[model samples]
Target: MFLKRIVYFSRKTLHLYLQSSTMSTFTSRINMVTGNNEWIFVDDDDFDYNQELARSAFADMLHDHERNIQYEQAIIKTIQTLSKSTKKIHVLDIGTGTGLLSMMAARAFNQTINSSCSLRITACEVFQPMAKIAKKCIEKNALSHCIRVIDKRSTELDLENDLQGDRINIIVAEVFDTELIGEGALRTFSEACKHLTIDNENLRIIPARATIYVQLVQSSFLQEFHTLKNLSETNQKIKIPDGCRHLAGNTIFDLNANEIKNYIRPLSKPIPVFDFDFKSLNDKTNFTKEKILENIQCDYDGQIDAFVMWWNLDMDEQGEIQLGTIPSWCYDDKEKEENVQWREHWIHAIYYPQQPKIVKAKDQVSLYCFHDEYSLYFDVGISPFPPKSFTPTFLSRSAVAGFNNDNRRNKYIQALEKSFSNTSINRCLYIGDGLLLPLLILEMYPNIELIILQSSNIHLAHTLEEILTNSSKQLNYRIIPSLDKENIDFQTIDMILSEPFFTKSILPWDNLHFYYLIQQYHHSNIKLFPSKARIRCIALEFDNLYKIRSPVNQCCQFDLTPFDEQILQASLNVDATIEPQSLFEYSSKKPTLSSIIDLIEIDLDKISQKNKIETINLDIPFNVDGICNGIAFWIDYQLEDNIWLTTGIENENDSWVNYSKQGVHLLLKPIEIKTGMKLSINAAFDFQQGQFSFNIIS
Candidate 1:
């Protein structure tokens, strides 16, 4: 009974869980404007749903030809090796997202033998939503007859009941997290070896093994993403307090490793940390319960600020098929020049120690990694030092890091410095969410009483209060979520500052939370920092960007015609969500066509309760010779009379601090255009809908 109960989990399901669990936490209320008939209820759940719907993970996996090619080769190899047996082929797929692996197995089985032999698959998914979707995906590809999705987690499957008393011999799972052993790969394999598979010694795993590698580095640029403004810098040397270096945190995000070389200077060569064999991990249940420690001697002496990590996989038994996520620079010059496969699904990891350690070239230290089946954490101790117990914790440090490095923050600081320089405007009022502007205004104008309008994000409100109270030099300020307009004297307020950012804002224009506050004092003479702003757009030829949205008709040697039909039908009901991306970070090889165009220019200092256009249309003519995949948009703010903050700035000569900033709207399908073509864009900014729509008049 125990032999029939175990299963495998795919990398796709792990990606799904990450998306659902990492959504931003936001507070909401029904905000009904004077002119708009629709009441806006900005909630986190709805925002998260929209965000997930907008992600093209399925399409991205489909377009990843290298990943598919490896999986196909591995599946075919496993099938061919196992086909010598007269016994039926029994397989298990864990975290079966979109049923891609199951479909691959079904295709492999058909190619290996005739229909007389039995080939059965038990695709298990703990996420019911994905299970239903995977069923449709498998059926659409005409593999439903051989593959059956069991809407249950692998741990929950009963050998006798769920598996129908059959033991699985072929386990194809891609449950690896960025940390490799993350996502319970070890625990899942251990359980499978104990209960799911037959007594056969040659049970096959898709990824035969994975090895994690790490390198130490001294990176001031990477440190900014972890520490806030308290760590000031002088002449490229940061003054990070001793207390700030004690907590090593992991930065888990998609990083173009090759580009990271510009910011980080390596202190040591890549060193292998540990390796996990998925085929025989039954006795390794302790990996998920406690810390796994490794001691390594320092090869170079430097300020060890971080340990950069990456992993590579042996996809089959023969090791002929392989996939690696090491940044391009890690390879020699020859491989760097080659067009290596760069994937967004997997990237490098950074382990920032609890305390940055200084060591000599011959010093030794213990690097400890801990996990609890779902996620990973890391810590380090000096050589001969006792290993400390490590427990997993999650915080919104990433959010803080983002605010610290945001290009908008630099613009805000500049605006505040320019505004308060020898000016008579004394009293200042700050409205809207976010930390950058208020922190700057207080520090620069120490004497002026700055009144800040806070929101329901208690963590942010408390953090701000604590930061202000602990400052060596305090400023005159009042913080509250709302003001009693009836008791306030709007006439005395001389300056109004707003980042135009709100936690509840899911769309770019939703920052109008600032505009809503401006409406209260329209009759007053208060000066607005950003007197005007506009939503701008430009046509672009995003080389492979659109493929993430629409299914590629031909992938490898397989045709996704039926899958494309499913995606097209679903697109009718599921409107694409606009996600913020670092447009500049994409490969330089991709091309952009046409000039930037302003869609709607709004006067921030003025508000009208009488007239508003429900829809606005513009005929944009273009003469570009490129594959027009989509339009990229961003907000351009007039920070001051001559000062500007444009999120869409792409000028190489521009002296502004550059960061990733842009929102994209991919077309339903790519359109080909020559030099003589014109594009008519019809757009509507609907305040009632609390969203905007753009369509090309073909």
Candidate 2:
């Protein structure tokens, strides 16, 4: 019997992997062979690598592969929120597989009263084969008059061309992966917000918004599930870092996605959730330099290995895994996917835990433990009194003592030189989204290319499209976008500009969206028509496509564009802070300043959830070795250290919540500056604490 074989191609030659045991030796040349070869042997045909690459296309794999079911929920949900005016709305669909949702939107528009204007849906897909199939699907659905599929990558969707007409009122896409940035989302959403939006008019993304959440949990199904073999070697002790769980659980961001029978093990920890709306495109474009949220407290613990954030989006009311359609793309070939569920190729940050410990939960009773590739860690018990401090032994790759082997400045210079020599493009500067850090780097890289980016703006699409359509086009070379992130790109690009989040957004300025649309272009290989005009940047979005709640009022209805700061202030006044925690250290054992909880003698893969963790607490005036990357840690600091807010005389009437953090001593230094202020300050030496005291200025 002929065994089932799956075939696909990258830049290399074709690979044929058998799904079952009833297979034979793999051969590719096509020559008439005699019968009865141990395995099935057909004609031998030798094909060149270039020819093989030409033959490779993801169309068939994306369209006809019975692995995924098609869903139209995103379109339906989008239509539900639209009024007669929103009819014939311009819709951009990114990663349009089979054009199912796009077709639905077109059909709905044809039936809407506000259909006087042409209803358009721009669909983008990279794989030539898949894009062709999507067109055919659109035709079959009788949506050729409205739905247009452009088989291009998101970054390639230039705002100058594709976005030149009337701005799109909505965007729909299925660009989310485990970690939002992993699936090339950074470049996709960023461009869309910059160049594809409606001028002054409001646009929507199906599913309205997306919420990202992270939590710590325990799992033990790993060992038995993996089908262990080399018992002795596998059981040997391994070193893991503090605050790291051996088993990083696998789950889908799609709310409706299923959980397979087998689950990966993980340690339980408090979960952090961040939410964003598409209409609010500022956060995704924010850069690292000027928009820095110092000690933003991704985690509360002192020791932090990394901040791994995942994203889940609601495409439509049906919660379509792909832009509000029926769940399809998220699924795997059940018959063949017994070993894995879903995964994309990408890398994120790794901020490991600090040595020793800072603050541990004062109420916990048991110890928690886990391990990373480098060291073992544990959570010790809380203490009511002061403890002796010591130097720390860091086993993790954190910002610890000697964290950097070489000077970062020198490395930056070298990289700048290399990029200039390679690209033959000099006077280059690197810019990324941040509050204040990137600007500093600009001064350092001034001799080369100059780059400046916003920490809260998603305006790279226009600039990117200019480069793509002008320079050799490649989606990988564009600025990345996000809903909650400041900025995140897939493949590294050139200089960055101001972020869209904190900076004034494009929506406030009308008529610019259409100008951007006019500047779009398609990739060279595939000559997809309407798709080239498709705003892959804006067309493939899911947030802010539905009910738009102002960022100020997380739960309130927010339709007015350019959300008012006063509303934000009002939201802050009512938004209560949850359980607070400052820098924390979680180890299976006790945490002391300069102490290390080494999980050296532990079997990482064999680690079970039942293994209890240790915890230690701190009350007053103390220091610890370890740190936590938890939200509680940040909120606590926000409230206690006076680091989260500040006030000036001009802003005395403005009792605003400063989203900024301050120094440790300022926590309780409540200055009672009266109407008129005077100064009579003096500086004196305090030899004991090796510091000077703060004199009052009245």
Candidate 3:
């Protein structure tokens, strides 16, 4: 049977090879395996047209019924009010991905009573592929006659050719990001208002204005992400270099709505920071540089670590039709909050202060908010605006993220302390792309010699060196750029250590590179910090995350299945079955549908003798009656004999570690199961390829 199966696989592979070689298109793309941009030949038909769609948050935005309904209502209101005065309405839809807004305007025009009144919609999409899809979508909805899809940016649109000399009166756009102006909304709107649209009272924008709100907060949880803390409990301390100390951290986008309560403690009530009138923006509008000082009184006595920001859009001129990105906790109406459509396209943003400040209750502090044409940033406590020419020091965002994970850091420290107590380590070889573990080991065990095999990330290596050099205690360590076995004396090496961080690791189990290294240098004397690893999973009934992968059969009364079919085919052609996602950032209720089930376990000590492929089959029973839409998977490392560290859920509540993202296998077709229903799951790990495959049998 095994021989027959192998024969079948070989024949299938040969057939595919021949089929692919028949015709191919040469293209340059980043090679994941080689970590370089290289030209490669692929089958012409195999090109993934859904690459952008697969990575986009469009599904989430489409699933947002509130946004869709509000946009349609706003469009209908604008068209109805303007038709009374004008015989024709020329509408401009900017960044019209999938052309939903333009269609909405077309539908609104169709409902008008004036027989002579005509609607001309010009939708400009910067991405040519999406513009093509938008044209198809509009044609599919039978609105091609009214809506003209231009495959160009609004800035590049020629008025005579694109609009045919028609003056645009209604401008509808949804180009905002987590940071309201992060996507260059100011520039887009300014240029459109000046060159494309008519400057009159009848002219209107879908989202008339947007108001940004911010609240100061002191969060030790968030502080760890921006600032480094002492790794060891000993007298030795890790000091930040003078250069990095005063550097302003990058604004963190897509802060999970769930994390607002889990990580932040508000120091002040939500204060309105800035307001941008989209309708009023023109080329003459000074959006280049602006600084505003708002006096805000502290509600609590605490250190201001970061500020949480969100925005509310006035969909119409009256501000009655409103859409906000405010957290659920701050909502005054409980019912509205309960029914609020959670959207990932635009979420909360967290901005770290260049320097943390301490303030007492009732003490007034001036919040300095600043912005350029493209980005918004904030400062606090009466500090002078940073010089226009000043550039902030660069800190690796990934490095800060990895170090900020207190849960992961504590586990590593505990495992190291426990391992050091039982084992005698004279010399150690650390193989990973992290600095914390190596630095901690050197600091805790000053007498031992540590060698780091830093395959990449020279910045981390330099920072590690600077930190070590500046320390009071003399530490013995050497960083080797590559794994040159000739330079290392393996006979004297007592242990191998790693945080299991690799730049190439997209999934959790990719860290198995460390295990592969152990197998390569199989030494019985060397003790491994993570002696074993297990790949585990749990079925999930996602609230909205499933939509990101699911087929969009219909959206806003339009059949979007043609677009969905293309996306589905593209995903099948190029995308992985399982993708990495920060689960905590996902807005869901009781996502966990089943208890954690171990899919496969690897004993590091025995990995050297293992086969090329390992398979496991299990029956996963549902704990709740709901739709099982996804499978969340993660890795658990047995650091010591009894000490275990999980990259999955931190608790029974299903909240994950803030920094690490987990693997989510989205089911193409969601299945409804009652409590106690079981699903047969077949999981296989290909050691040779370092990849995993899972199959669910209903």
Candidate 4:
């Protein structure tokens, strides 16, 4: 009999493995092996470090300052709204993570209510561990008397048994996901209103209503993250059969409001799709699941490649206090100033329609939005007719335009052209993910014998072959899906072109997939396009980017010191964290060579599969007055002798080129730096684990 093992890697630590009976002395060991540096064997019952880490991450929610501020203010406003009634204020905090809102409600009640009465808050959390943590947090804040922590879900609360048969006056919940309702918000709210709250018309709910909004956009950048749209010129021109609709993939990501203008071009004004009222939906049957926004006029003449969606939360009934997740471009001059608050908890979602609608300015269209119990979907059409059914076909189309790319394809073509103009190649081998490179080589070197190392995606390969057939060109090429030294005749292949992409890659350095493909044959005298690669880093001063990962010891005038302490203890035990960040969207204090440090350089011709861990420690000197938030890192690929492609820091004066992924490692807390300061930095990378760690040594 054979036993199976499951392996997991922390972002900045050793690889961990789990197997049901190690068959080694005793049940298991905890990071017990020495000098292997590759694997860490541990038992599932011994530590459960992953579960602890998840609990610690709950404190991270407090770092969303905008969310905290809005909730605090809404709690205060709700207390005021219920103050008119002679009945004692009853507030229920649903899914309370850190008891932050319950504490705020208690404090607001303490301030708003007179000496005759007191405020009571019932805090409910489904997760038992989180409930315990919240209880500790409430006790630490001295709000234990006014707030009660329940360790069960809101639906489990018994009216006659748990609440002393008291009817609640106000209900507060932050139980929303990226797709507004992904966390069963509809069901939870419906249950609360029907059973938990009072029957009075004056009953109040924090975040009284939420309105969904949508705007048509033209963005290939957004589309690339979901699916590779077949982008051949002939494919772009190919018309779909009449009445044929292809549903593109649904995309959800935390889009930065400030940097959206640089990547996406808007084609239509933002239109309000629908609004969901928590107070109005007392019965589950009364809930709405579909809505249609008809006759929306297009303001621009272009291909509607995708739809940008976001929502606004009306925290109070009067609408005096509201929180919105609109991109910076949509905000007026007043809202762009320092008065407005930004949030990471809620960001815009980009949706690709069933088919990208190509239209002229002033063209009118209707959009139908459908929602299941947990998620939302949308479809678009030129006619004002409503969709026959809520469910749309899932179609991944290959129709993409050049302008939609922001001209990245043009840059790659130029680099390829420059490389080909100098070398005379009779036989070429293509090793990359996309078909663009192969198609370009075929068009440029008409007589060259080309062999493409095709991607594992058979559909994509078939699409590429179809594209070639559609062009009506006679090209000499063979698509080889798999490669090894035994099958390939290396003696005849002279040059290799690669886009350096892999489906399994998650970080910038994962492009080493390109190196691994050709390393075995490097000594055979075959040249590679990117002959060299360098990894670079620079210290950065983020305006507010570090808050997402920063320790939230205090928020909105409340002391969450206990939660912060738990996170600190967890950090002291682990060395794993390589967080993904959009560093290009941030501004570097300086672009000088002194500010930038080249961490490691790899010779594409010499790298091997058995590479060892590399470490670097240096005392870097600061030359400017700024706050050190994190270190931004990117990769530079040397395509030819002088020409290169980089995802590193690009000059603001120059146009943007590389769209490759970059990374940022934020410090535990931001530090103020001045000129003449010596900053000690140490970093290590373990290729086996595909993890990197950065430490700021005093």
Which 10 successive residues of model 4 have the least lDDT summed? 1-10
| Candidate number of the best TM-score | 3
TM-score of each: 0.81, 0.35, 0.90, 0.81
Off by over 4 Å in 3: 1-22, 25-44, 232-234, 240-248, 282-286, 382-407, 517-519, 587-591, 606-611, 650-654
Question: lDDT tens digits, residues 1-698, model 1?
Answer: 00010111111111122455753333233442222333223323344333333332366656777888888889988887787664688889887777788888888988875455678998998765567767877776777889999988787888999998898888888776556665678877778767888874768888888877878777876665555554234331222233322222344433555555777877767877667777766464676544445557777777787778888889987788887777666777775535667555555777676556787787777777655555555556532212342212222333344456656666777777777774678888887656767776776667888888775465566657766776666568878766676534678888888776665444466666676666757554677877787887777776555655666676654455555655555444334445555554454223346656778777766566214654567655554577777787777778876677776664422222223346777776777877667788777665433455677777
Candidate 1, residue 476: how far the Cα is off, in Å: 1.3
Q: Against the true structure, whose lDDT is highest? A: 3
Give per-candidate clash totals: 13, 161, 0, 3
Residue 604 of model 4: what lDDT?
A: 66
Tell me the tens digit of each residue's lDDT in model 3 across 228-294.
6656556765565654432224555446554457567788989987888886664454585556565
Score residue 596 of candidate 4 by CA lDDT.
Answer: 64
**Alpha carbon lDDT of residue 442, candidate 4?**
75
**Model 4 clashing residue pairs (backbone):** 12-576, 230-398, 247-395
Q: What is the lDDT, from 0 to 100, of the residue 507 in candidate 1?
A: 43
Residue ranges of candidate 1 with Cα displaced over 4 Å: 1-57, 110-118, 125-145, 231-251, 259-261, 282-303, 356-366, 382-410, 421-423, 485-489, 588-591, 609-611, 614-616, 619-624, 650-661, 687-690
Question: What digit string (tens of lDDT, one per residue) describes model 2 on residues 405-475?
Answer: 12322333344344345443322222222212222223233334333332223433332233234322122
